[model samples]
Target chain A: MRVSLSTLRILVLLGVFIATVLFFASQIDGYMNARLFNRISGSVAVIALIAVGQAFVVLTRNIDLSIGSVVGCTAYFTGGILMAWPDLPPVLVPVLAMAIGAAFGAFNGFLVARFRLPSIIVTLATLAIFRSILVQSSDGSSITTDRLPAWLTEFATMNAFTVGDLQVRWIVVISLLVVLTAHVFLTRFRAGRTFYAIGSNPDAAAFAGLNAARTIFLAFVISGALAGLAGFLFLSRFGNITVVAGLGLELKSVGAVVVGGVNIFGGSGNVLGVLIGAALIDLIDTSLVRWALVSEFWREAVLGLLILLAVAADTVLMRRLLRRKGGAA
Target chain B: MTWMRSWEGFLFLVLVLIYALNAWTSPVFLTVGNQINMVQLSVEKIIVALVMTFVIINGEIDLSVASVMGLAACAFGWMVQAGVPGGWAIVIALGIGLACGAFNALFIVGFGIPSLVVTLATMIAFRGFARVLVEDRGISGFPDWFNALGQRGLVGPVPLAIIMFAVLAVLAFLILQRTAFGRKVYFIGANRAVAEYSGLDVRSVKIRIFIASGTVSALAGIMFAARVGAIRGDIAQGFELDIITMVLLGGVSIFGGAGTMSGTILAILIVLALRNGMALQNITGHIQTGVLGVLLILSVMVPIIRETGSRLLARVR
Candidate 1:
């Protein structure tokens, strides 16, 4: 008599996506422009990069609150390196950035894996510590470039291709790649499904001898490394890095991960959902500015509302499914 | 008793040592005036940390405390400006805090979600609400009586707010040490289902801890307003992390089942002393934050290293 819970959850989210798109569509009387698209997509790319990495951690039922700091550390180091050697290749920056991030991520995983400490606490301690290092290292000065290598900024804009009078940025292309790769890794790869299995039931996964430590450690490394890649792009796009740069990102990325329907308790949710969640959050920011009727102070309120609505929807969906299954029983 | 069992005593010794060091190094540090100032500044956050001890000990977190404090401060100040009696305003202020914590608990308990993500969302969401409530501007001009909160002291230079915080801390220490509810809290935090099977009223205990945390935060909110006599959306900036650092450094396990208020108070003093010492030494604010970060990592590392060392000894023995 009613829609199944999983389907209903998707349908509700799709409905929200559609409704927001339509509402925004109504405002598309040429006011929607390239600069706006660039700004929104730019913001989405940074958050997506972190969220995708966080997705890996969350898949293992562990979380890394240090992603924002990882981004900061990597970006600052990237800036320092590139500024000293401006002529050095663009590809090299990403490589260094990823390595630094992976080292930290591996440390996180090691603490959880070797010491068997909780990921939340270990990451929490590192979050402040890393941010502190960034603050001290910079001494409040931003690491910036007067100009980036051409390829560095290429990800920000697409290949001048037109689709129905709208141009998607190259970052959008990257976003698709990131999301696709994430989806495949989670769904198809041996390591990917292992993450789901571990998160779903850690004890059983351990009993199955899946090397929970390696899987979790790798997840954190991927999360941290990807955060580094994101950091490189962040510097390239924003052209600035300071003490507060990438500040408050961990929470926002967590918000994105949580909103995307990845259970905080872990075990469920997909990257596709998170990608959509990321876009929706971006759209919300744009739409709020577009509406112009309400006070701008409502930004946090609306975000809180979205988180609540998602949790509420999740509860209702779960209850409905439980009721159906129990009734059959 | 095991060390963890008598952690309170060990913690008190550390507190004494810290105070002694402060007294020895800075001639002005132990002076009644400076001590009062230290107490006045740290009370609100200390109170919040006090209740947070219970929440975290119960295997939950309330990241919304800062936001609740922000919203409460905004509401309390705005109401007083609108001609609400200060006493009645205090009541409403506490109510707003309870409401905010309860709102967070709504999803936490109602949806069986982890408090971390829920509170983080609300941290943004509620801070956003506060921002909207008082759009980027701070409100001031409280009655002169409000200023009395910061200036007045009872019994030879102990600020009233500090005195009040001390009283609350002592009462909390007693309750946590001497009450069935306290034991139940530990039980539930250590293991929820077992406590439930023991008929310990886990839900009510949880809801009550949240209320206590909310009320403590609200009290701090008002006291902060009284102390500073100002209301702004951004008051207590980055305070949530600071309090958590104090709590964790105080030796409260994030996973719950262990921790003491005495340790929390000691940790707060260590942090306050560090901050005060850093400030007196002319360190910048950024550095102060960095020091706290350093302290957080070091305190965590020390115990870990201690355990590792002892374990190695045991194996060799």
Candidate 2:
């Protein structure tokens, strides 16, 4: 059996990720080691959820730059609602957030799919618009931990399991559930496979009787819904919601999706790959903190470099793969 | 009647209606002083938007423009504050701008990487580099003459920045309207494969456009630093959205191949007038930003809607 390029890339990244963590764990103190894993799991939880959803959209050869803003907007919506009515069940928070996110996503789909506007520009515009709405509604103030109901904050920090001394939070479990569900849908469902068909070649997909626009729209809507879910996780984990709650998240998710072996041009990748990609990004962040060699400012710069390297490698590898196939035929 | 069917005509009518509304609502809206001030505030964005017009027209985007502006300004501020001569600092800033543009071109034009992703990476990377340079601190104390030039006018009530922008806009207009290069840009944007088969240097044209965008953005940064009299790494952080908004609102298709400088100029004025009137009415900055976002969406949506409507009509006929 031929090992596909995406699977191979993920394997290599996973290997590098484990080796880096093991090497650093041996060199660092026990407290720092626990701290490193804690940060990785916690941060990766929210990012993985967002990245998984984003992978769907990117797999359709369209990008969503508005998810970060959607996250911020949805978090504020949930946060605002909880503050206004403390008796609201904690479960309702994520539901409301997902609904709001889906609405925004539908709007984006309407423009991109119905009208056929470029997705990037449509999302960029919405990013600004959604963020401004969040700001205006909040009156430029943050909903802090004090305002959050006790149960909501408790759920945020609830420990799911312990690995020796390192405790895993419930958010990690939820993130895993999201990933597994998405993985199954993408691998097992006809609707999920259509996304790849659309991304690979929309014209061909259309000719083959696939509803390309509908599939693309579904991908974006799913991405938006997941981002909204991540917002709730963010609220629980941080216990604070500001106008800038999820700033720069769009780039971070894109970075993870690309690094996770998803083609930037779309048509390939999986939820499991995004999980590892999200872990690698968070690991890099935590490692930089643990080593204390580089300033915190370098994190974004490093993420940028990682995105470039990931995309460049994918492009080169893909060309080589195609050439091999062509030669054989 | 035919002109009314065109995008520029629609923009002109909108501009007129907005101008009238402002005049009716605000007693000072008709004053030349306030109008000049409005232009001054948006001049930097306008200048960058013109170059962006070319980029979008050529079927690519430069998301790194705002970051390049921020980076160039930071570099200039660091140099001048460190006692480098202002003249030399300006040259160095332009050179940095050129290098930044070339970097984008290398990935996009050379490697065939999507310009959107390449520019997105540079946008973050370049902004990161700027933040590392200036951190949270703001640098000031530019040469007196330079500050005056950036903030004040050569002619009565005409800012040097605004004048420089006008000259550049005219030059861009000519290059885009009257030159063979401009036609080539449209050709490539309309169909890159066809342009390549027709013997056009598609890669080189794309490279040149990205470079132009970078350089113009850098220049805008210098003027911005002069206007503000300080430089911070986070300066112009979200300006890319506004520049792109203005260009698109001016009727430049986001997919490329159809737009004009006149339309962009008209759109910029409309935005300026709207923001200026809102400021006069004491509207919050957040609300103003929201309005621009709505305008951005509507700009693209209207065209799509019109085309769809027309297609439906034709099918029925």
Candidate 3:
């Protein structure tokens, strides 16, 4: 029955989200053609999947910079596999990519769990390592899937009710799947709740007899797996796989995760909030493009602005709440 | 024994071994002109890594240094475009870089924001700002005489940049070692809470380090502009990875609190020589990233591996 402050903030962001959607829709006729809209939404969908994975990592108050590289590795591997055997069912691409992604994730897990190395450093190193794999494997070229399997085409196409007022790519469907699943996992599942508790206060979690290292490792696994799925979706949407395909993605995912009200210090956010954050970031980028900021640099500026606003808002609200309760943070 | 266990010691071994190998493989490896060229190229990165040593030591990372250089380089371009004297342009660019660096410090310190978060934001913003200023057009066209910073020598075979590098490195070394503030930074980075409890001004210390990082990165930017005689947004793109790799390779811990200027200098040389040697031997650019990636991985892995192995033996016993 209680509307918590965070819940209220989420509601406000949703409302802002709707308004931004309308603003873009109105400009749809003039600037964003159906083709452009489809492209933008599709890329956003792909990015959102990765962002959700990143949100999970950040949820435990850790980070994984290797998501972009994971995406690159997965996408490249999937694309490369498909290229090698064109007749093989494209449906298996996700499974194959997910397996590769899981391996990378497990390695990240091993480094963090066994060594107690900081997540950022471990992930950063792997970002380079995984990306280099794609580069070396591809020999500085891209592998394009010949054609989408029929089922994949069905999964990839996005539209309003499929009748076609506004064409939404199938990426939107997958993004929702990732988001909803993550949301349920974070809020309802035991491991998910444990992750939050661990992130909020690792020592407290340990004192409560939680296996902090294992939980962190699991978090990384989930993050990597989701990134792998996002990579599949990336290939399903963009046929070409380049060495730099997911380059700079880690930072963007961090931006979306943090901006969505996820605490950088770990714990205290949910997937639903992250989805909203991801949508908002996508909306901002699209709107900027519609406004004719053809120079791609402004995109970075917008991202920085969003990160600052979100962090400032989260920190201020949290501090105020603590102050009002007359307690130390 | 401690010294031998240090980054300097490790890098020294790498350098000696690499140098010996290069001499054995290629007679041109140890020539004075070629070696000076390597040092000359290393000047900017060495200086920036010196300051970054303090930044990482304070438990923060700044990804914006390369971007800061891009922007600072633009300051010079803007000067020349506005018809300022060449020397004036250089001075003004350096000043602007300092200001930008200080601004980064202010944002991080004033807002109590994490350095990673703040600099990440600024990295995009500054780069974007630089892009807008340049508007996809590069500014060159400086007086030939003004180009002497990159062109002329400092008494028989030395570059002005190299001299600048040594002086700056020593000053940075003193700051990080002799100065009380430097000591506080290392203490804070090693453990912020302990340092805070010990009455160190963690906030101020971190803010100053950010500024120092920004300043040095900007100086590097100016020199890069001067060296290549151009400035653009994507000019130094992807360079952060290179600098960070060099900084980390120099013995600076990624998690912070343990490195030295001497180590950074050795790292600077090793990176330069490796690249130069590779070039002489014709290694591809893409593979070089792989090399750096492997090196980056090994650096982190080796330390963690040792700790893990030692702990494992203890646990098993």
Candidate 4:
């Protein structure tokens, strides 16, 4: 009959979400509601995609701070390619971006797994290194709509389906599918399950014959690849690309994953929770603009506060769980 | 230790080599005025780096230091612009830094949360706070007397800020290398549980170290504002990387329980000279940052490589 802290948190989050939606519904008309949903889904898609990858890394007790830079670099790289070859196939662009991201991730993995350097330090270096390269390569110039291929821009606006006059973008569906697949993999796959073992206690996992370093390395790679994918989505959604396109997104992904009930110290939490967490964050972000109670300037501050609160709550709940276990034993 | 035997010695040689290269290549490199200006550019960052050395040596980090510097700088500028005395504004800036550090320590030491997570959150939060406080506009136009201390020389070619850095470096070196408090920081970093069991008050030491980081960061913030004569929320953006680069490049182990003030000083000088040399050669800022990033990765990698190589050799024997 004892529900875990994570389950309790999810329930509380659901209640808050429902209340917020109801409050907004009462304040705004049905047309505005549809518009809000459309906006939320569109913004949440890229954020959720990055958050899912971050969740994988966090579940392995490693963080990929370079994710934002990877997304930025990949976006710029994609932009560069499209500008170079206006006739290039749309599908191949994403593949190229993912490959680039994977390479970056592999570099991070080698340093972390092979050298045993901390993920934070390695990714922190890569974060600057990658962004600096992007800036240097671009020479501070940005890729605008005029440079992008016509098909890619059209693909950005293509609708997946309409539900009662509410049109959902194809990008949202793609992000949702990503979430579903990641959820199943985390729940069922042996490789995914090994992440928890490594995250919770790498020494114990190593003793049990798990290649903790390799697993952690793979986590970083997956995170990187997903970030690249997210970059593709970012490019399609926003045609204008700057050198700082994905700046501070690593913070956003970490915030989403932690808020989704995945422990910041790693191990535990689900993708479904991350989906909800991403939605909540984007909702708050947009709401700041809509409500005008607080300025949009406070978005980063709020994200930070959310992370701190979530971690603090998790810590207290975990201690309680431990105390209860000790009492029963 | 022999000159060639220590990391500081290695850094010294690198410094000399860079000096030689710069001297041979750039016409302005060897002048006393230019050299002073070169060292002056990094004084604030080096000040922050000195405290960061202690934080890293204690097996903790405060990513919020740069943000703290920004916020404090902005606050000082705002206060001075609002007609508060410059000296009082500096005090207020340092106070803000102290509060910021205490906030980090409370969550980290009191709540028993990881310093990384705590500082990461504060880093974002504090920067956001700075943005909200100053918005997009920058504050400037400080008094002549205040500007003189940070931007000009008090003692013939030695800017007041440089003197401050030197005095602080010596103090940090003494405290870290000579005092009981310094020894305890190392003990706690090496093994926190063991240190705690021995009743060395690990939490207090961590709190003190974090506070020192905040205070020093604030001092740097005030100095930076004086030199630049402007304060923006974005001041010191990405400076955490440079400060960390210096600490790591100085041979300070990111893992904690290792590093020295002298190593950090030499590393700071090397970076300052390298930056100056690059500027003289007309290298762009982004390229400089890229080089530093590569240097940071290599700084941590080389030691690990050496250790592993030694282990492999031992196993082979």
Candidate 5:
């Protein structure tokens, strides 16, 4: 009958998310509809993938600030490849995008794992480096919808199934699969457990015979690959690929990971929470645009406030819970 | 041998080489006007970087510095547009900066939250506030005197900003190297638990450092407004990372407690020189930023690489 602290946190988050949605639904006329779900769900899919990747990195006690730039790089390159080889198989495009993303991730991993460089600094540098590479490669041109294949554009809205007025797209299904797969791996597998072990206490993990460096490196690689998959989804969702694509996604992904009840200090959190976190953020964002009282300028402010409150609440609640538990023990 | 072994010494040699390379490529590379122009263009970021060195060395970060800069500048512009006197607007902008810093300090010191997460939130919030104040609008047409403070030289061939930079750099060096407060900063950074155990007022010191970071960032924003003769929400949008890069490249340990003002000054100069040299050679700005990113990485890695190489050599011997 005992529930874990993480489980309690997740339940609280879910409650908050539902309450907010209800509040928005009551205020905005005609807010409870399939169109709103379709819009928020589509964008949530992209944010969820990156957030899941970021969750992996956070679980390893590190961060990948370059994921945004990695998304931009992979998205642009994938678009260019599809444009060049229009007759190529549709299945290979995402694979190619993931490969490109993995390469960028490997570069980050090498510096952080091999040199013991700080993850924040290393990824911060690579964020610029990767974006600059994209800028130089793109050379002022952008890949518009006209240049991309019809199948790719169609894939964005292609429905997996429908129930009444609600429709589920393939991208949403893909992102959910990725999240569920990551959730299982982190919870059920030993190799995946190493990430939490390293993050919680690196010195202890080392003493326990874990290869801390390799695990950290693997975390970065997985983050990179997920970002790449998100990039492919991005290209499909938005047929235009600009150099500035995915520019501020790093902030959004980090925000989602933290707001999802995942410990920012790294170690205890689940990808299911991240999925909810991403949904909550995207829901707020889309709702704000429709709300007449709040200006669009307040969107970033709201996101910032949410992150601050989430972190603060997590700290306060956890302290009280732990104190009570300590007394019982 | 000792000088060669030092990070600053190695940076000085790199600075000299870049100077030589620039001088050979562009005839105007060594001119006083071009040199002053180079310093003027980045004076705001360098000023903030000086304070940022303190923040980082104190074992924390202020990701919101750039956002504070933007907010301060926009606040000043908003006030001026509403017919506030030029002098009072400047003071209010700085006050706003102080408030911003105190806000960051409250979350970090009072709540015991991590500085990184707190500042990251503020970074977004502050920028959003700036955007709200001046949504897609650029405010300009400041008083001539204010513009002169940034655009015209106060001393012959030197503007007011450069003067402020010089004074602040000296003050920073003296305080960091010669004062007891500076020692406390290092001690706290090296090990906060030990410093607290030793009876140092860790919370007060941290609060002061963050407040200083906020106030300095605001001052830089004011300077930016004066220099550009305009203000917008996106002013200094991505300058935080660039400023941090300069400090980290100066050999300041990101983990805190170990860095010198002299190293930071050298790094500022090296970055300025590198950018100027590349600009003179007609390289694109993006490419220049990319090069600096590489430099940021190499700066941290070089010491480690050198240590490993030496270890390998010793093993062979």
Candidate 6:
């Protein structure tokens, strides 16, 4: 059987994930417990959402460095709104958050698509601008758990069902559904495939009658909306929102996207791989705290190392694979 | 000269208007002391910005520069605390910076990875290393002379940092505008394949530029440590924002192969003046950052807007 390159990448990634979990299980006492699964899965849900969003942007050969800021902004704003109106419908709150996030993402997309500016530079500016807006608006205040509605705060740990000491939370299920939906959309829909077409070759895509600019714009919008959704999840999970709430998550999401076998340069990858990547990263990050030998300060360094290694390994493996295929042809 | 009608010229006019406005608004804005103080505060970023101009112009970026600065500063602090001589500590800290740069170059050039991804990872890793070295503790109380080099004005009201900036600015201009190596940077950035076919050692040029960025960033880090008279794990964190802002605002193309050192210097002045003016008016740091972010976006957008407007006009004609 001949597996496609992306499928092979995902398979290799799954193998690595299992190997890593097994390695950690042996290294740490009681590492294979249900509590570990619950903690890691809950955290992975937040990161996985953002990583999926980042994958959309990266798919179109653009990036949204401002996603972290968008997450922070939406989370804080959503928290503020919920605190003001505790009786508001739960569905409306996430909609409002997604609306706010989409607005910010539209601004980024407009600048990049309309002006044909480099997405990296534009998003980099928006990143600071969005954070600064949060800082200015928040006025040195934070949204604490005490002010949040009980339902929202309790939703974080509310389990959907338990399977032999392992409890599956609602947020995890929502995240998984999102990943699967995005996966189907990207593979099965014509419009969704435009992202890959444009990313793989913008000129050729344009020549083939595709609206590259519009696709790029849509990618950012999706990224922003998803990030906003993640922000809502973030608020529910933590129940505390600060101006720095989503700081450093931009890098983390990018780490997940790249490590999940998505080409950083764009045109390849899937959300399912990103979900596994998020789980792998959060697993290491949470596990490192209990590993004893690695200090807390070393976590960010390990994340960086993992990204570099992932990129290097992808390049080497792909090259070897391509060469072998060329020889056969 | 046609240069007077270019973007830098327009920036010069804006600079003058800002200076006038600042002078009008604040009583002490025009004073030599205030002017020197303004430059003193951001001298390190501007210095690093000088090298960053080269990196951007060469079609690459070093996001790791700020983290490299943090690492160098923290390493120096740790070594001093470990009883290493201050002088030796400075040397070793700089060596660490060079190593960090070489590490970036190795992956970027050797492994064929994009500079953005490589530097992003290193940015985190380098800052991580800094945090590990200092571990939330503030290191201070350096030898008196070492502090004096950063704090005191060696040339009568002009501190050593200012003097260094001046010398480096001139050298950067001369090297960029007048040297064959400068030409190679532009050629490689403009079209790497063509440059290679034309027999330029594109790899060597890129490697050298990154190494220079690392070294300059380290020097800036050391200067930061000296000026603040303290060191911590988060030293120079987010400084890349301002440094890159300066370079990009100066009209350096993010895509590489175009820009001038003179534009960057003017941008440095404009940014420093803007920040200083805002501080004089008691604007908070975050709000000021917000303004710079706006400027950063506008700087990139305005030119494209102009070009498109002109094209539309031509079409109508």
Top-DockQ structure, candidate number:
6
Residue by residue across A1-329, what tens digits does model 5's lDDT show?
99976788789889989999999988899999999999889999999999999999999888889999999999999999988999999998999999898889989998999889988889888998999999999998999998899999999999999989888999999999999999999999999899899998999999999999999888898889999999999999999989999998998999999999888888888899999999999999899889888887888888898899989988888789899999999
Worst 10 residues of 3 chain B by lDDT: B297-306
- Candidate 3 yields a Cα-based lDDT of 0.77
Q: Where does candidate 4 stray beyond 4 Å?
A: A1-5, A20-32, B1-3, B308-317
- The TM-scores of all predictions, comma-separated, are 0.92, 0.96, 0.91, 0.96, 0.98, 0.98
- Expressed as tens digits, the lDDT of each residue in B1-317 for candidate 5 is 79886888987888898889889989998999999999999999999999998999999988899999999999999999999999999999999999999999999999999898899899988998998899889999888999999998899989998999999999999998899999999999989999999999999999999999999999999999999999998999978778988998888888889888998999999999889988888889877878888988987776686688789989999
Model 5, DockQ value? 0.74
Q: Is the docking of candidate 4 incorrect, acceptable, medium or high quality?
A: medium
- Per-residue lDDT tens digits for candidate 2, residues A149-176, read 9988888678999989687999899899
How do the residues B210-233 of candidate 1 rate in per-residue lDDT, one tens digit apiece? 878877888888888888888899
lDDT of 3 by residue, B213-309 (tens): 7777877888887777777767777577667777777777777777776777788778888877877787776677667766766666656666777
For lDDT, candidate 3 versus 6, the one ahead is 6
> Which residue pairs in candidate 5 have backbone atoms (N, alpha carbon, C) closer than 3 angstroms, thus clashing?
none
User: Which residue pairs does candidate 6 place in steric collision?
Assistant: none
For residues A6-42, what per-residue lDDT tens digits would candidate 1 score against the true structure? 4555566678877987776676555466666667776
The parts of candidate 2 lying over 4 Å away from their true place are: A19-32, B308-317
Q: How accurate locally is residue B311 in candidate 5, as Cα lDDT from 0 to 100?
A: 98
Candidate 3 has a DockQ of 0.52
TM-score of chain A of each: 0.90, 0.95, 0.90, 0.94, 0.98, 0.97
- DockQ (Cα-based) per candidate? 0.57, 0.65, 0.52, 0.74, 0.74, 0.78
- Of 1 and 4, the candidate ahead on TM-score is 4
For candidate 4, give the DockQ: 0.74
Candidate 6, B177-252: lDDT as tens digits: 9999998888888888899999999999999999999999999999999999999998998888898899988988
lDDT of 1: 0.78
Q: Across all candidates, what is each one's fraction of true contacts kept?
A: 0.59, 0.55, 0.43, 0.69, 0.68, 0.68
